[model samples]
Target: MSDSTAAWVAAGVRSVIGAHTQAQDAGRTDDVVALYTPDAVLELPGMDPIEGHDALREAFKSWAPTQPQLHLVTNTVVTPGAEGEATATSDVAFLQRGESGWAVHLVGHYEDTLRRHEGGWRLHRRSTTFQ
Candidate 1:
């Protein structure tokens, strides 16, 4: 891919990541699942790897917070590859609001594999490592 094409792919990958966090934070389970491929896999820190869109939807719904929550994603680095594939790593700060105030709930890094789909870029696999 040319440098310009690579740049565009990187931006698209980052957008997908950002959209996932935003949708989840807003408790939009369906929207969050839409960001992934139909057969996507989500691996959180503790639980087993949740496979496919149905499982992903259920997992996100079950984890919906009672209070406000936010996921701050930063330092995202995307590596473009052949065949419409890419990988990304990002630092994430998961925050939740309680009676006291907003506090950090978890600190983690994400390793993600993405692919260009008919609709757009979608996450094929996402693995989180908590710190």
Candidate 2:
């Protein structure tokens, strides 16, 4: 890929990751699942991998936030792969508001594999490790 094309691909992948965090924070289960492929796999810390769109929807629904939540994603690095595939790593700070005010709930890093789709870039697999 040319320099411009590589940059575009990285941007698209970053957008997908951003949208996923936004949707999750907003408790939009459907939107979160839409960011992933139908057969996507999500591995959260201390949990078995959640696979497929159906499972993903159910998982998101079960953990839907009741309080205000925000995900601060930073230091994202993307690597372009052959044609339609790419990978990314990002640091995340998950915050939630409670009676005491907002507090960081989790600090983690996400490793994701993404693939270009008709709609855009979708996460094919994501593995999160908490710090």
Candidate 3:
């Protein structure tokens, strides 16, 4: 693809990563869900799929109290698609405040489908698996 197209895809993926970290750090569950499309779905291990914004909101609200101190995304690959759609995958690490300091609480990856909206790219679906 052209350099300009590649840069746009990178920017879109970066926006998702930024929103995730910012919302988690601030404990803004609403903001977290806002990064998703209204009909977005989230799938994580051992839990039924959370579909739509309302369910996504509740899921994030329940998680916010855990206060995961850090959200890190790395090794991202974004593939732009036709008609303003895209897909991305990234390695993620979640850190928590330990008695000593920040400790690795979880390691995982996110597989996402994103679509451009009025505001920019928004996640249409996200599947997360922790290891």
Candidate 4:
């Protein structure tokens, strides 16, 4: 792929992470769900895959009360595929406030599949493996 194509794909992947962090921090479950495709699935270790936006919304609701202080996304690697599809992997660090202040709630890596949707990229599948 050309440099521009690579950059564009990378940006799209980063946008997904940015939107996710913003939505979660704002406690907008619906907005968080909107970052994925209608039929998207999210898999977390030891839990059933969260299938579809509705299920995603419910899952987010259950977790929102924790009031995460921050969600950091880093080390993103995006690989373009044919037919407007791409795969991305990134490290995610989640923090929450404790008596001592912000401490890590979770640290993980996300394996994601994204597709071009309405002139932008949207995640179709994501699997999280905690570190």
RMSD of each: 0.8, 0.8, 1.5, 1.3
The number of the candidate with the highest lDDT is: 2
Which is superior by lDDT, 1 or 2?
A: 2
Model 1 worst lDDT run, 10 consecutive residues: 39-48
lDDT of 4 at 27: 86
Model 3: lDDT of residue 31: 86
Q: For residues 1-131, could you state the per-residue lDDT of candidate 1 as single tens digits?
A: 78999999999999999999999998999999999999899998778999999999999999887899999999999999887899999999999999999999899999999998885999999999999
**What ranking emerges by TM-score with the best candidate at the front?**
2, 1, 4, 3
Q: State each model's CA lDDT, in order.
A: 0.93, 0.94, 0.86, 0.87
What is the C-alpha lDDT profile of model 2 across 18-97, one tens digit per residue?
Answer: 89989999999999999999989999988999999999999999989999999999999999999899999999999999
Residue 65 CA error for candidate 3 (Å)?
Answer: 3.5
Ordered by lDDT, highest first, the candidates read 2, 1, 4, 3
Q: Locate the minimum summed-lDDT window of 10 residues in model 2.
A: 115-124
Put down candidate 3 lDDT per residue, 18-87, tens digits, no spaces. Answer: 8877886778998888788899999999999999999998888888855448878888888888777889
Per-model TM values vs. the true structure: 0.97, 0.97, 0.92, 0.92
Candidate 2 global CA lDDT score: 0.94
Q: Count the backbone clashes (under 3 Å) in each candidate.
A: 0, 0, 0, 0
Mind sharing the TM-score for model 1? 0.97
